[model samples]
Target: MPLSDKHPTVKRRRSQLLNHFLAFFVFAVIVVPVNFFTTPDHVWFFWPLVGWMGPLALHTAYAMGLFDRRD
Candidate 1:
């Protein structure tokens, strides 16, 4: 069965999914290593914390309109 456009949540979820994928790809391949190397060794916990939280945090903000663009 095909998804109907009548459900607003479906559209929101679809948008969220696209944002999540884009966020994951950008952070995983580009941002992770840069932070891993440049960060100080004393803050070892920061790396994993940032690595996991960054994408979720950013995406959540975007979806919530906190980090949205006007253009």
Candidate 2:
């Protein structure tokens, strides 16, 4: 369905998903290359990926209504 025709909650979830995806993309693009060239020996990209993934997972759950209290 088109975004304009979806319910408000659906629209909000879509927006959140898009925002999280873009943020992850930008972060990986910048951080991975910098960590690769600047510290080729250590290769610490996993640290950032771990940190970001935790919150991203939580965000996905919340956006999917895992935490919603529908009574």
Candidate 3:
């Protein structure tokens, strides 16, 4: 076996990570403009984007093997 992971679940996590990134990109694209035009002062769009980023970051770390340990 290789030093890296070779599990089906890891593969799924990587795929999900990509999909999540794409979805978040689309969400930001849509919300930013709407928020800007409707209420430019508050910039409420920033909150949701930041909130969504936390999960994405954790997902990315897992896919990158940041939490993996071999014994």
Better of 1 and 2 by TM-score: 2
Clashing pairs in 1: none
* Candidate 1 C-alpha error for residue 57, in Å: 17
Q: Lowest summed-lDDT stretch of 10 residues in model 3? A: 1-10
User: Model 2, residue 54: displacement in angstroms?
Assistant: 0.8
lDDT winner between candidates 1 and 3: 3
Q: Tell me the RMSD of model 1 versus the true structure.
A: 8.1
Residue range 4-39, candidate 2, lDDT tens digits: 436798678869888998999899999999998999
Per-residue accuracy of model 1 over 1-71 as CA lDDT, tens digit each: 43466567557955886877786667667655665677755445446546767667776665555544466
Pairs with backbone N, CA or C atoms under 3 Å apart (clashes), candidate 3? none
Ranking by TM-score: 2, 3, 1
**lDDT of each residue in 14-71, candidate 3, tens digit only:** 7888998999999999999999999988879989999999999998988877787766
Candidate 3 wrong stretches, greater than 4 Å? 1-11
Question: Which segments of candidate 2 are over 4 A away from where they belong?
Answer: 1-5
